[model samples]
Target: MSNPNSLVEGWARRYGRLEARPSNVNPLDEFSGLSRRLRGLRLKEWIGFTLLHPDWYSSLIIQDAHYLASSEIYAYDRAAAALHQHAVTMRSGSMPMPSALFGHRYTAHRGDYSIEYEFDDTDGRHVLAIDIAETATAPAISGELHLDAAHAGRPLSVSSRLPGRRSRMYTHKAIFPAGGVLRVGDREIVYRPERDLAILDEHRSLLPYRTTWLWGTFAMRAEGGVVGANFVDRPEITGEAEESCVWTPTACEPLDDVVFEPAEPADPDAPWRMHSADGRLEVEFTPEGRKEVKRQLGLFAIDYFQMFGTYRGVVRGAEGSYEVQGVHGVCESMRARL
Candidate 1:
């Protein structure tokens, strides 16, 4: 197992300039294998949908759910293990447009669970609806989350070609003040309009057989305004182009590489320290809860751990410095063979 952080230094110098992509650009339009000559090898695409609240975090994922691949639909409560459920479905063939992982209108149904994801406007506002019936492993959960992103403004998007492969990775992240209503069995949870926040993570990539990455993100209310951060260390990217940023209400500031160090690897609730090389961002994350998933099936396997906690430290932005204490969010480390 090699360290992924070692692959990010001098990334821009070796790979050239990493540009800021437009928020309105459709990722499917930039497929590297669009030409007729390279269509045979274009086989991977996926989307990860997430909703965050102060008390809990919910995720609905449709990975390769539209094409000739083994698509998976899973929903989980980040704070509780009793609310996790998943199902796998196999598609017969492949199609180009209106893809469940990329297009504006996407929906999929498997067993008694169904999910729909849509991009509503150019400003990164979207909707995600998930309905799950009671299963043997979890209770019934249903919600229609409306992410009105007027406050978080524009998104931070980046695209890059994977080295030594005919593939590209495009990622878009936007954080906004969110409000919705959820029903879990007989209990109802209401997310007030001005009291909650959510993050939209849209990832479309053509990846290799073996992939590994470390990712961390969070959004919370500050004294004056809102704050958000996205950090990643992966083999497909490096240098100034790495998807790292500190987001404010007015602007998004690109950050240098970040390093994640855990106080103890065996402890899921261990404190983790995160810092940037340029001294612009620093924080200590103390985990309050965690969600762990492990799946192994011969040639394909995934091991993922996500910790929810509060950030206590300071972050310097363009306007001024802001102190963060007891701000809620999540941090994760993942290794996958896809």
Candidate 2:
């Protein structure tokens, strides 16, 4: 077994920071150091795409989104695969989200069904759009979603190095009002800026061959205000401060490490409890639906499970305390051998 304290210290020496920075910094440029400065070292690059709403959550993920992982790139529609279309509804007793392994494609640059990022001194934004004709498992789906810092406020970003590997993790989370329309055949779910909230979970990393982590994020209306949070626990995250924080309309409050208690048997429908050591955050997650994918290919495999659900809790910040009730979000557990 590894000494947890020693692992954390090692990470802090390489990646820990004392403060937060704005999200406008280009992640591609930040992570380019090792690859650019050194030769014959391995690097993995990709952008995850996600769109969240009160009624549902949709994702069109393009791993190796930029074809930076290697000289050759792949795009396929398959469970536990890198590129695919997925969606989950939030209704009570709702069925699992529809996932189809088709209409998967990849581009090296920003274009239709591609992930795009732009940032400058004045603003920053990341956009993802996809259009899939009707498939065997679901209806036609199309939509465009972007996270705009000019409108949503600055995001929280973290950049760190992986232990014992010539790799790094650069990630950012932006929570803001999202406006778009996801048309599922004839049923259109419009995301109005006045009512809907969205979060952007952008990550690019070159991880070890085997990795495991626990992550959860929530965004919703609480006590007449908007609240959003991102929390994670992984062995590679050795920094003194984990990538955890709570975002309000006006400010982002950095938080200490969080503790998660998954129900025994790890049932998807069971209530998962989470809280912070300082007593600043506490919540009970009741899952409505889940997306589970398991893939095994000789030496490489990925077992990923994400639970979409509603949260009820209390969050204390510099401004005050906010009560969160029936707010929709996601919690995930992943074990992977890359």
Per-model clash counts, in order, read: 1, 0
Q: Using Cα atoms with residue i matched to residue i, what is each candidate's TM-score against the true structure? A: 0.79, 0.72
Top candidate, metric TM-score: 1
Tens-digit lDDT track for model 2 on 1-338? 11122212322423443233422222233334566434112334434444566666554443441212211111222222223243321221121111111122233232222232332334454444556555565556666654454667346656666665555665656676667776655666777766676676655555666778888888765544567777776775444346778877677787776888977554668988888877878988887666776768577677988777778898787888878888877888989776
Pairs that collide in candidate 2 are none
Candidate 2 Cα outliers beyond 4 Å, as residue runs: 1-42, 65-127, 146-148, 222-225, 236-239
Task: Write the residue-wise lDDT of candidate 1 on 56-135 in tens digits.
Answer: 65555555612344333333344454344455455623322232322275666667777677766565566767777877
Q: Residue 41 of model 1: what lDDT?
A: 38
CA shift of 100, model 1, Å:
11
